[model samples]
Target: MKTSDTTDDLRQKLTHELARKRALLIDRHPNARNSLRIMLTALGVTDVHHAGRSVEVLRQVKAHHFDMILADYQLEDGRDSQQLLEELRQNHLVALSTVFIIITSERAYHNVVSIAELAPDDYLIKPFTADELHGRLIRALYKKHFFAQLYEQLDNGAFTEALSTCERLLGQESAFLFDALRLKGGILNALGRYAEATRVYQKVLEQRVVPWARMGLAMALRGQHQLAEAEDVGQSIVTEFPEFTAAYDFLAEVQQDLGKPVEAQEVLQRAAAISPNNSTRQRLVGDVAARNNDLATAEKAYGNVLRRRRGSSLKNLDDYSNLTRVMLDRGHAESARQVTDELRREWRGNRQGELAALIMDSLCAAKEGDAVKARHAVEKAILLHEALKAEGATTRVSQKMTVDLAQACLATGNEATAQEIVRQVAAENHEDRAMIAQVQRIYSKAGKAEKGQELLAQVGREIVELNNRGVLAARSGDLQGSVQLLVEAAERVPNLQFLVNATKAIFTLLELKGWDATLAKRGLRYLALAQTKDMRNPKVISARETYQRVARKYGVPIVPLGPSRSPESGPG
Candidate 1:
């Protein structure tokens, strides 16, 4: 335990760790990347990569797992390092164990609090010495090592195991106690134990007023359906710490759920103004603004979204369609036509993209009062839609696009086709208030409001009856009958609620009557489908836990609830 001996041990550890690491240097200029590469090489990192653009950074991260990433704050694509980090973490493209350091020239970067849910491991100021960089890497690697097990459990979708790990870490007096507490609150919230999550956040708040802890508490309150209280807390965070943009998003969601669309639109617009480069937030603003009949705002927000994602890998047909739809709504037929032309150019030969373009072309022609052109476009779109549906490629099309197509159909005098399309989408998304509202708007626009109401009521009644029958069968001790009925309902509707219910019923039956491979496989499929709809839903989590318990009892391998990603091996 002598000072000299401890120093020697640390030196050996650092040398070994650096030698085994794969490092990435991201900067707009070649000289900056070369300088950083030299520094990394001097520190014993032999595996070094360089990326000069944000797109290249994303490509490299997706293609390989790097142990260390050093990115400049100002990227060549106008995106900051903070935004890149947020995108990586949000999409689960980066592992939690990677040591990310922001290399910045601005001293203000060090003083600013990160508004993202995930913060970089460290910030490396310009003109820093190799020794300083070495020290930062060692500290970040040590923290990653300390939380290795918990990170693994979380990445593997083992929330219960991660919670236990958090508890064990909290039992000791370590520098990471607060970090462990933060993870514990998130895990509890993910598991739908909102009351416990609230208490954990409260405990953290008692010690200090942390923005993240307050945000966590607000989320817990929302999970418990305390919308008013959640809104109040969210407002406080926005007012007191205006830099914390995440609060704006949370508050907007709460407002939307509380049936305050106008308030939600206002909140999202404020956030978009503050973080104009955030494509996701811009898209949200566009959606809400369109829903509130604010066409000018909708057009601007959607235009921003398309501009931001124009040449990026994240660009999609939805972005182009959204802007075109807004333009058409504003009676800018020529503008909408231009956007549709761009869509065709950008997504050439892609079936879904072609379909989207055709639909938009039809809408544009109708708006321009060209009945012949509109009819021709509608016929082509109808043919493509049928072809995709027959080939089972319809699932690749977004629900929003499908609704838009139906609206086009109504505009083109294809009432039966529009009605059929709306009916199918409504049944599949019976619980999605937003989609339902969109469908209602389409019908109302066509002056068929009464017909839309009748259709929705019929779909709602059918779903309720189907679910009630399954419940009745279970209550009567006919477990087999209950499973059959529920599975049938899931196959027919395949919404989140039905999928979760079916999976739960199948797992319950398996628990009572021993494992049936066929039944378990079906249950897993439904659970996966439900997760695709909403991975963080309490119902999905509960269903996953039930399946895990049953699978363990029967000695079956449990599949992960989240998407599979490359696992990171800790430092050697």
Candidate 2:
């Protein structure tokens, strides 16, 4: 039969079915039943063009600004039921409130099982009764309304309020208890309330070992700097739910933070193997490989991203940046230049991207022996960073960038300017070990190894002296005096690893030897500061464990603070 004739007959059938079910029909197809047309004469819905194929009609209705959409999974264009549902979701034409129904034959059940991505609000198998459709539709719409407020708060990033709404719904209706638990856990995790989040996750684990709940709990533990515990939980999760991609992602992050780059790369590789279609996972694997200087692996990963290019958007500038750097390392300077040029053109207006592009440009110019152009680009890069700082951009153009500019200046024989820039940054960040290391490396590259070593030793001695005074004050039995001395010491050397580490040791000793509640808390504050200074340090790890043990010994219920803030943020 012709599509038009078939649609006409189906429209009549739908009219009879709606009357049989006592429900209204808002068909998007142009075909209308003579009986339905007469029936609509009494009702409303005068729009006709808004009413042909279900998928296109829904898209048109959205552009035309309709209140709701009633779409069947099957359409007249020989598209299967699942494709229609996927299209709606991908296009976001189906809002959280939008009601969708799948019209399928019994044979489509096997097809439905094969399709992992399509999800409809209601599914109607052929030979289903009209009463079943009405009952299902009413339930879906009512549930949508019930969760409307919760959805609204989440969309607006008011995660705490979303948790409150979930609590209210879960109390009044047992049916939504699991959903409430999930939402509450998610919000608590986002807010860095990991200890409380762990409790919520424990409740979820009681019912079932959900991968998401397991991953959430693991993340909370990781936030607490409890890497061993997080790794244990992640291992269990991946073993049981090997297909869960997020579990591997979290595992990779925790492993990388714990200084296990090879393990992290293996985890990411396993995840990519299981779900080979994920471009982001491919990119991450590439990054880990590139960091290890595994150019071959990095190239393969970048090739995957290039093959699936989403077209000239700044979709993943880091991947392109890393790719170019890898190419440069491999001595494929032309390929490196080509990638940088593409990114430069694509991200011309983005200040951060422009800076990155400028850095790459300077590097390229230096390689080509164009000292004049390299000097200009490096100067431009520094000015761009100054502009960003003035505009209060949250992104930091790290002190490393300053070091780079200095190196470029030095290379071009602008020794006075290079020396001045390096001196300014070194003086300003006198206590930052990583920045110190970077400065030393830059000077060494410029064949000034003795000067770099002298600078590093000078900074180290200043930090050691500050810490010694604080320790002497603490050892004098002046607990308050000790804390005051240490606090002042920390302020003076906030970014110094040795100074921060000493502060942490003092706090640990105080927690063990004294019984002051405020002092114990203060100890935690310092331990967090130490961890921030060197997150993966074995000494920081031991100090944190000692602090936690002391807190538990006193029954103080010390909440593990989430991801340590930068030491410069100070004491909070």
Candidate 3:
């Protein structure tokens, strides 16, 4: 009788607290909402917000920070609650404090939840009692509150503080102990203490095979520059834990770092087959396919990204640009024209889009044997490039835009302008061997390889001399001069490691002495450029981690500098 009374009192307390929560309930069926409403009412939740569609739920989620969001896993519009969770998990609109609970009737939803990149705080299988629901909510809300500070510190780039918190929390026996260890490993990696991170991950693996921990182990190995070991671990994860979708990205990255783009592309293909609904994975598939000149696969992959990200905020222009390139390469003149026309129609005022569309228009025109129209379109593209010169564009965007322009000029019989543009491109990508090969391919396709080889070697020599000058400035203790010189060199030769490393060194010097806002922005911008040069490159990763340490000091967000591969998604 005493045990029953104690349970009753605890249940009553949870019901009362759950009642007081500012909550939202989402379900597609009216009967389902009625059933859930009755349960909430029985739990003393008198007031509840309701939405039937993903868009409606998103609107409410963006407008308010609710105490709880109970979303049905099954939904309309080809978007399940799992996709919605992934969408909002970017933290752009949803607050970290919000407790999300997935409500599902199907066992398939459980599988989806397991493989999802951004999982809900809790999930309630259908036919659950009001008491059971309340119990799960209590647990989830408690966890949200418990881990709030650690996440805040980490997101603000205070890795040192975050690390301290993780260590302190790990000392206590708790349900979140594994999470704490995982975060500790990440913090150690960000601090460039790869050896320490590897040890922590090893401890976790000895206890159990957790993909999150296993992924951390691979990352630590990669950070330590043990590519072979990292690949071994990554490949093992893929072979042993296929449901751990993150393994594919890690393995593919290792393959790319090992210069096996073909193998990496194959890994992504397998990942896409497993998770076709992921926009990031689709984009990556397109990227790797395009790099391998597999136009058919690239076209399909880019099309998938455009399809999947149709109504979401995560849609990127890169997909459209890449798709457009493939369409033109396939000799689909009318089709390519239609795409460029649509591009111009939508991105009317955007500089990069306008330039890209113009270049595409020129290419299509030239392919159709209209030299005059091609020349006109190429001129517009050149004018757009000149107009955007002073504005800062990402190296990826600039490289694609200029490369398109050069191809257009070459096709239009404008040899002088084409040569100048190729020279400029070669100069900028001086240290990027792959990019140089691509430039040579472009010239060879246009029957100008002799000129391309000459320009590549000349620009490479110029970049070497410029990098040396920047290094001398650093050795002389003229840190500011070193930064200025190296920044210039980096802009002229975006992937030149020596120049980027020198710039990073100056940024470190400034941070050690005192923070300069101007230098901080410059340093981060150069780091962004370096990352785009080689996503899996260890030097770039090290530079990014170092910047994260001082990111808090300089009031910068801890957001990554470039795009990331997706490890999430299965259709509902």
Q: Which structure among the candidates has the greatest lDDT? A: 1
For candidate 2, the TM-score is 0.54
Q: Which ten residues in a row have the lowest lDDT in candidate 2?
A: 563-572
Per-residue CA lDDT of candidate 3, range 1-572, in tens? Answer: 13234534644555557767778889888888888888878777767888898778878877776778888887775667866777775433555567888888766765876676565778888779887986887777666656677766654444567778778888866679876777788767666688999999899999998777778888889888999999998888778877667689778878888999899999989988887776787878887787788989988998888776654455555556668778877777787787677777767687787888888888888888998998998998888777677565534355756777888888888888887877877776665545676687668778888987887888778877988888798899887777778777776666648545754775677677777677777777777666555533446655765777666677866655543211111110
- Model 3 scores a TM of 0.79
Runs in model 2 deviating more than 4 A are: 1-140, 157-160, 306-316, 345-355, 368-373, 383-572
Candidate 1 vs candidate 2, lDDT winner: 1
Most TM-score-accurate candidate: 1
For candidate 1, write residues 1-572 as lDDT tens digits: 23344544755675677998998888999998998888888989989999998889889998999888998888865678878887777567777888899888756564434454456888887889998999899888877877888887777667787889889989866688778888888888888899999999999999988877888899899989999999999999989877778888889989999999999999988888777888889999998999999999999999998998997888989999999989988989899999999999999989999999999998899889988888799889889999998998898998989998898899889999998898889988998888998999988988999998999999999989999999899999999999999999999888898899999999999999999998899999999989888876778877887898899898988887673221111100
> What are the models' TM-scores?
0.94, 0.54, 0.79
Scored against the true structure, residue 223 in model 3 reaches a CA lDDT of 80
Write the number of the candidate with greater TM-score, choosing between 2 and 3.
Answer: 3
Per-residue lDDT over 393-473 for candidate 2, one digit per residue giving the tens place of the 0 to 100 score: 613445555666676666666767777667656654675544565577667667888876776566557656866777787
Candidates ranked by lDDT? 1, 3, 2
Clashes of each: 0, 4, 0
- Local accuracy by lDDT, each model: 0.85, 0.61, 0.73
How does model 1 fare in lDDT? 0.85
* Cand. 2 Cα-lDDT: 0.61
